[model samples]
Target chain A: MPTAKKSYSTGAFWFVAPAMIVLLVVGIIPLLFALWTSFQQFILPKVHFKGAFAGIWPIFDAPFVWLSNYRDLLFDESFRDALGRSFLFLIINLPIQVILGLIIALLLHRPGHEWLKNVTRIALVIPMATTFAVVGLIGRLLFNGDFGINNYFWNLFFGHKMEWLADPNLAFVSISIMDCWQWTPFCALVLFSSLTMVPIEIEEAAKLETDRWWHILRKVQLPFLLPGITAILILRTADILKMFDVVFIMTRGGPGAATELISIYIQRIGFRSFEQGMASAQAIVLLIITIILSRLYIRFIYREV
Target chain B: MIRLIRRLALSATCLALTAGIAGAWTLEEAAKPYKGTQISVIFLDRPGYRAIMKMLPDFEKRTGIKVNYEIVPYESTLEKEVRDFSSNGDLTVALVDLVWIGTFADSDYIVSIDDLKKQFPNIFDPNYELSDFFPLLLNAFGTWNGTVYGPPFDNYSGLLFYNKKMLKDAGFDKPPDTWDDLLKVFAPKLTQNGKFAYALQSRRGETQSCDSFMRFIWPWGGSLLDAKFKSNLLSQQSQEGLNFRQQLIKYMPPGIVDFDHIEAVNALAQGQVAMITEWSAFYSTLADPKSSKIVDDLGVAPEPKGPAGRKPALGGFSLAVAKQANDNQKAASWLFIQWATSKDTAKEYVENGGVSGRQSTYKDPELVKKYPFIEPMVESWQQGVPEFRPRFAEWPQLSEIVAEVGTNMMIGSTSIKQGSEEIGKRVEDVLSKAGYYDGKKKLAQ
Candidate 1:
């Protein structure tokens, strides 16, 4: 029994040893170093390296600072307005992705629906595979303020022109539309895959109880897909939190910081200003907020199931 | 067989390593004049680099000293230069922007030319004909605290670029001479088919902070720093300057505030704008047959006057030897700098369309005839002052505040007075953190 215990400990050590080393070197050491540095103010190219043992004191020292960076962000009213606009995007995109995915999954899973289903699945998944950067750039070109194809169509439709990214309200909507076009198919595929995992027995029982399609979906299919929907929301919120590359390369938080997000603000402080210490503090705050929101999500929604 | 294959691979690896080390040794031997020496030069990878590359063969041939050059984009080079100086490394021979000389000089990044003259006269070269250089080019970016820091390269003082054809069509024979004249004569001509009258780079970044904002600031008789490196952006003159830029946007293309250097240049090249206040280097691109729509019909002049007369923003590069460099590499680097900025060399460069800061280059009758923009540039340079690119270690932070607030002002999102005051407050805060200011007074004393 002693020999077996020894062997089991050795086996576990070997399995976790690489990851432990990586975590120590890449994660813990840097986190500790950043934590030590964030308390002291920074000027580019020089810091006295006078690191005192400042625990969570820096956070408490300026309770208003969180509001300051946020206030600096609020100076641009366009971005403030975009928060509401983003809701419009979420409203349109969420349902479209879910419905399209569910319908496709239903048709494809119907036993005999093979060729048509496979073709549709391949076609739908292709957009998901395309790089988001390329998609956003193409979107910019297609919806260019002056010469884009969309502008031409818009002129034909309304007998007038629209500066897609120039207008504050439209700029947010443009990015949202691009995000939806690129990511809706991805959500659909994930939801569709989850739909297949739904037990056939449950669906058959529900159908017999109600001949109505809507009733079957409301009772059987959607309830089965609840976990998938939650996963998508969690995944998307996390992804959106760090949305930098596309927005950076495209708008550059421009037309007067209209599309500037938290990530953009963080990048400006960290890289452009060379205030790494403050950037680390900002990052820590953003992380805490993300964690709290995630916890709330799990508490309110996931625990109910 | 597996053992034999492993042995073969090992032998090959050893051979490659030996070859690599041998190549490195040869390179080191060639740099014997600067052995045990490392010099770091931070510069922009643009026209400034082109001149450096052109003269590298000559430099290596003469000095036998290897040059360690790091070329970054123009926007980030200032921060990188500061980092190179602040770090423990012997960062010798940095190519800094003209505006940055003050910032670098204040922090003791590079040895002052005054110090060099006293201690290292061989490097100073009083006979180097510093007087021959354009006084504006020499004084505007190079001089700090009454001492020169580095020689100028590829001068890019702002010039008024106009469409001669457009001006003629607008019933104007000459380009506008002042801000008021620009609005009165050119704005109407420039606005056609839903296009702006003038194109200016107002996008947030270095361009907004250094070029566009400074262009307005200087002409409006405003400055960024006071005598003691304090913020002066909230001055009455500065407020007026900020407002002038915002008002100009009214007559500009839709989204003028969003236009970066490339976009502004493109607008002028495509004949979308009648005039553009831009760098002199832009003339080369505008005249290029492949890029410009109206090549022959283009004209250049001194930047239009504002309240203070023609005060075009200065933009160029300066070569400063790193303080941490060893005596030998410093000497070798100084030798290269001397040769590069020599009257003969600068004139040769000017003849090749490389704008030289040396006044002697402008006096070269053939050179002036060949490049007509040179003389007017010299005149503009003579009218030039350093503005606020004086010795101030906190200039970089001040630049960011200016770019951010100036951009807001241009878009009409914020009032000029409000934006200027905000910039002043932010700058004062930064300077106070640096111990350069104390809100109501300078802290240096």
Candidate 2:
């Protein structure tokens, strides 16, 4: 019995070794390097070393300005504005994605619509299949005040065209609409898979107790789908925090920094301004926020039946 | 025996003559040692890059050096080049924008022309004639802190491109001669029924900073910085310019604050707007029948003067060798730059939809007649402001602040005075952080 237990442990070590090494190389190493960079003044252009080690040794030699970058970022109005904008984006997008996704999942899970279910599932994947940057370009064209299709429809309803991309509030709404359009499908798919696990006998019992759809959903289905909802919330929270390519391609945080998210702000600091230390510090802060939010989700929302 | 000796002597003399002619350092000969070296650069989708692509085959055929390029948009070019340089990536040639010269030069990301020449003495063609380029373009686009880093490749001077039919319909025979004339005379008459008189490319980013915001202040004799590199934005002259821009906004399209160069130019091309001040490189687009609605009615003229005088915007890119490139790649890249910007190739480049910086290219009567924008472009270039946008390493950070506040000012979220003050304070803070005030770094030239 002792020999059998030892053999099982040895077999598990071999199975985990490759994944652990990969995580160490690609993930852990870069995160550690970024953490080290946050504590140093490592502006790329300022590094004066030359030759083969030019890219390396100077980075190590960069002046250690402990907490200076973090202090500066705390006082930076642009960074604060970006952080607030990202949170606002999350607040606006999270509820719509969650509720709408669950509704679509429930419809797909309804009995006696097998053919319809396949077609609807296939159609839903189209939005999720489109690349983020291409989605941004499409959004740009769709929101253009001069000749976009949205303006055409809007003019038919109203007497004049609307400045969708020009107005700050409208532009923010447009970005949200685009995000929901692209990501809601993914949320729907995840929730639908979770719904497939709902036991028929329990749903039948809940339906016998109350014929009302809301009552049955609240009592039986929702409790079963809490895990999926929690997952969606945590994933979307992290995604919205780091969202960049679409916003960059669409408005470029324009019309007076109306849509500048934290990622865009950090990109401007690190790549445009070459202030690597500040960017790294901002990244570390964002990482901590993400970790805390995910913990909150798992702790509070993932209830065991 | 005598006849054979005479024939052999004649053949020897002929061979010697051919070798002597080939010894004059042609680009093809200079590229001999680095025949198979592959160099890479970032290019834009603009006319200038297209023109170069059209001429690239000839270059590759003459010299065995293969040139690879990635087409990047203007907004991404700076970041792409900077990232490539920092990482010592595959880019062997740097396509530098005018504002990036100081940044690139200060960071030592690019090798200076003098250093390249010193390193590769035999690579330059005798007929290159560097002085043939316009003095203004040479200094403004290629030089930083009196150091010649690159040679001007894609050069431009802002010119007013107006629709002649629109002007005539409004009872004017010609474009406006001054900013006041444009605002008071042409704007009121031409702007009506959803059509605007003019459109400024004010979309946030460098377009807003260089094309829209600085375009206003320069002609009013307001500089971004004083003699001591301090903020000059809150001065009376600068405020006047900023206010004038605000007043001019009413004469533009409803959402003019979001119009980029493509949209603004399209407005003119599609007859939505009567006039737009744009770079000379866009002439081909406006001239092409497929892209323009008023090609036959298009008229080109110098940008209208302000209270001070004509101070057209100067913007373009230069070709420099990357510091990360090996010696062979550097030599081959230098040869390509020299050949691409040589005096002999200027006419061909211009004919292929490029705006050449060579003074002689504009002087050609044939080219002037073919490309109507040439005369006005030359006029602007001759009198343009070299520092239309401040040429300094800190300008990128400063430009961001200006773009945001400038856009806010246009949209009425901030008054001209408030916006200028905000920009002034931000600019000072950035400059201070860079140690300019403490004399640790050199002041902008």
Candidate 3:
């Protein structure tokens, strides 16, 4: 109660200093640098590593071209398109990922299907374990318009082969499908772990209150899984926001920028267009948007669905 | 100013130390001043780089200058190279794709070795037969704005690779000689039995712009930009090429919208496709018995001509000195560059199956006899399209526009007219922002 007398022990401070310093160097410095760079007109060198960092700090040498890059983005259709695409991608992907995860967790929680559960659980982890880049390649192959097994089956069943990555909406759908396939297991595994720990007595009590499964889930089971859901939400949200490699591999922001997302747009600006100033400005904007969305994401994950 | 003076003095010392040491100063003696000095060279992990890496020990032993070479995947090589260039590291020299010349030159990221040739005749070697290099290739791949930046490493001229057995089965004695012949006549015949006539690189990347799109343009009597540096994509000639490509898609492998060099070449290697217009450097992939089923039956020729002329797809790399490189490192880099690009080493380079840019290497009877693609590849390099890609600072954006629209067109997501219009408008936007329309600057040559 006496405020623990500000226990400034060298042991504790040293114990935590390395982690704190690492966080400062790796996390904060880059954020500050990005913020500073976002305000300036700096071209990452063509030979990107040669001379951009020659000075004490690149920000000191960068031109103070404030607000211009942001201003340009106001009228830039591509940036807007990317933002809209990213939002849509999240909207489509999040629900499917979450619902599928929950469903898998429930199925896996069944007591009698240990072999099926273990096999399926192993299968779920396998996709999550694979690199996203490899997944993108697999996605590309699976949806290949020419010889893709998906299209081959679609031709057989639907009497038509869909243009998966070439068509804009289809490309988005394909990426979303891959996203669901790759990430649902993550959400499911987390939720399933939480489900296992939900105390058997509580489920027994809920069952007495009501034999209805939905009633038990809504009243008893979901509350226990909220923390897991929220954790999954945070991780998935962060991962989805900056998602680059999979989309890059699957679509490269193309089929006429149909699947282009904010990350792709930023990359195009910084690397392809060599407009680092604009890209940084756009990134700062994206960062702000991401931070704002993080709160909503937390709230949404924590709330009753 | 003081730094410049010191560099000049150091260069003088380098020259004096390495100079006048009688005839044929051994690589060891020449590198005495730079002994133990480590120089870093970065390039993509291709067959050519493997050849150089294999010979690296010999260089190290002779010069006493340890060589550190890093090979990255081709897709990320540009980003990595640029990342290296932006950092003031020990990266002495970088191998640049031809498309990067404008960006590198505009940034002054590389030292213009052309200017240094006269200043350090000893280092450059006046007896060196500069003209022995294919002039078209020299200008296209290694030179920028009338100044040489690097020596050619891989001379990639697009060649028509055909499944000889497939063509023979299809009752064709030879590969098509022209675009009309290939598309109208041969493609349909060969496309029978589940074999495609060609697998063009229609993927939305550099190959899409530089390989497939540009390959068709010149031969169709088209170019990327007009005299005023406007988008020529909407030009009649350009449309002809685009239409030709749209038509060719039917005969090409399905899902061509996703095919890059690897897929296109693989389709040929797997014998799923009858033919492909792939880079000469990929010759090894097609010839590898392990990867290719038709290795023995592979036929090669220059890209088929169009109404205007034979405009070969020009894509390759050159080894250029980084501007941030120290004097001794530069000297050693020049030495390694020369040795790797020299006629004698080139013979070995070709014999080992790395496509050497030197005309001599291509004309070597033994090499030609060994590699059937050499003669046609040489011809293709001779008539290569330097402006097939605009080679401008704005090229990346413009090329993206073209690739996006072109791929959409190929995939039936966008009409030829719509694709052409979109490409023209987007390119105009990029150029206009760069003030190309207002005459603030000329489009990069």
Candidate 4:
């Protein structure tokens, strides 16, 4: 308001421009190109058109199909089925991960207990550090119908075996377990750091005033842990919503679309089918849906934070 | 009398297994022009491919072409090939799946070696004979619409591999010849005490289509597409085949729906399963000292015949010279292709654990003795279904739809009638959208 500064050529602007340019090239450009490609019948090496506006710039050079692909996506049963399975995976996985994480954090949040504090913390992080491919392979081996450790132990304990990847429901539960197992540590570590920041003196005061553990937990610990819980909820929701690798490797979204996540379905459409136009439309729609859903989640969780 | 003759034949086989081929390849004089040339290829990480790598030192020495090869897993290898082909990447020689032949030929992504023979005379080895390859194998893997696109490499026809000792213990001295004999005779006796009689690769991907579902369809008189290019999945023939598969599913492992080629093979190799109707290319894996426990007791036979005929599942790879490659690179690649697939090198290739498309390799006295799978594999290759999974550009999408429906049936979630109808409708819709099947012309031919 004081004065309109002409700082376009300033050193600060120049230094930041490189980062902006890189972001524009890597992220924004592909996104915009994807949007453009969404409206075109652009199956490479065979079907294409030099777009109306692309001749001059080369960016707009695909035959526009005008939302037909989007219309097709709306009625696509497999896409809807994938979206449903993705939500189911999240519904079953996120809560267990968060709750388990919170329990682990609370147990490890001791001030003087170095063994509980350090070793358990290191052990919890190992799963998160492992790649999903390895995690999926490990999950498959463990859950194998014959000679699998899960089956072996399960038979001894329960007197029956579960077809982990054969039946649809079991496959869904198996993949969710794998996903939850890998991500629980991420939630736990993130919450544990936040738990550590809660003043011990305040906890001591609450504990002295209220002799009951539940009363102290309800009156003091919960309020203190709210921010951490909300953070875990928001992050875990975002991550579990787009889970791909474990589901892809373990079952390949199979045994009849049991574990077909949104990302896996997109891979099927884009890479396997090579229906670029249809895939792009599906992707754009999925991105919008995920954004809205995540925002709503964040809004609900962050209401009183 | 048949037993006595068989014993004598077995003795001859034992004697035949002792010797090795001496003059396998003669390349130096012809390959002088391409000396020190470098070319790259991407191959599936199969036992046959590992064998190729082992023989590379000899190949490099003989041809003087520095071969730079990368081995990728089968699942991701398809995606990589498509990505490379679509992007027009600088690939000198590319490994192509059989199903991609039509697309590659149509898109001109790969050179038509037969067509190019006219353009570049004297490219192949002077005595390089195309007739050496089994006609069906060469046609199914390399040729598209009568135009040869690539030369066959690591060809496979689905063959039955069984545990001989297990079958004998069950009181059957021989493998089943018909689908009826398999279920009625062998499977019941063998499937007992935490063991499975057979395993079918009903996984919801390429294996289901290329190896399992499609293999059974035609043998029972079913066809994926009729002469009109319309899906004939719901035809009476298809129902018979699918219903038979449903009945046979009983003797298989509980998680057969989750089994792919690798899992099925592993099950057989571990002796958890007694038999596998698997690809001939996996013969090495089953016989490998490290991988297989039943190496000494494996028996090979052509896939059991159905009502129509014995049409084993045909699937293989081809070494296509990338048209995107430069002239020198293309010429150098041609030399490698010739050397790798030549009739002279076929026996050596088989000796090194590589599957050869050459009929001579399968017919070789020593190679046949060393690998029992060779004889029946050759028989299966001759009748290998050309359109087992449909060789076309739109085939990837078509096959996916087929796999999905087939898997649904495997899980018992969908009836054969429902699954077949879904396949027919979906395939027709895809074909229609692709401008195939105009009302009058049919596009079937």
- On lDDT, the candidate that comes out on top is 2
Worst 10 residues of 2 chain B by lDDT: B18-27
lDDT of 4 by residue, A1-305 (tens): 87988566688888999999899878887787788878988675454233334322233234789998999989999899888877877777778988888777777775687875787878888998898889999998998988789999999999988888988889988888887788888878877877666688887887778888678667666766667777776677667666778888888878877777898888888877777788889889877876787677667655342
- RMSD of candidate 3 to the truth, in angstroms, is 6.0
Each prediction's number of clashing residue pairs: 3, 0, 12, 1
CAPRI-wise, candidate 4 is acceptable
Best candidate according to TM-score: 2
How far residue B333's Cα lies from its native spot in candidate 2, in Å, is 0.8
The CAPRI class of candidate 1 is incorrect
Evaluated on CA atoms against the true complex, candidate 2 attains a DockQ of 0.59
TM-score of every model versus the real structure:
0.80, 0.95, 0.92, 0.91
Chain B TM-scores of the candidates: 0.85, 0.95, 0.92, 0.90
Q: Per-residue alpha-carbon lDDT of model 1 for B322-413, expressed as tens digits? A: 67677776766676667677775776565455777787667768877777577667777877776534435556666666776777777667
Q: Could you tell which candidate, 1 or 2, scores higher by TM-score? A: 2
Which ten-residue region of model 4 chain B has the weakest summed lDDT?
B17-26
Query: After superposition, which runs of candidate 3 have C-alpha atoms over 4 Å from their true positions?
Result: A1-12, A46-56, A113-123, A145-163, A300-305, B1-22, B114-121
For residue B394, model 1's alpha carbon misses the true position, in angstroms, by: 3.1
lDDT (10s digit) by residue, model 3, range B125-202: 444577888898889888888888887888788889999999999899899899999988898888876678888877
lDDT per residue (tens digit) for residues A135-183 in model 1: 7678768766556899899999999878666555566667767776766
- The DockQ figures for the candidates are 0.22, 0.59, 0.45, 0.42
Question: What's the candidate order when arranged by decreasing DockQ?
Answer: 2, 3, 4, 1
lDDT by residue for model 3 over A127-191, one digit each (tens)? 89999899999998999887789999999999978878767788888988888889999999998
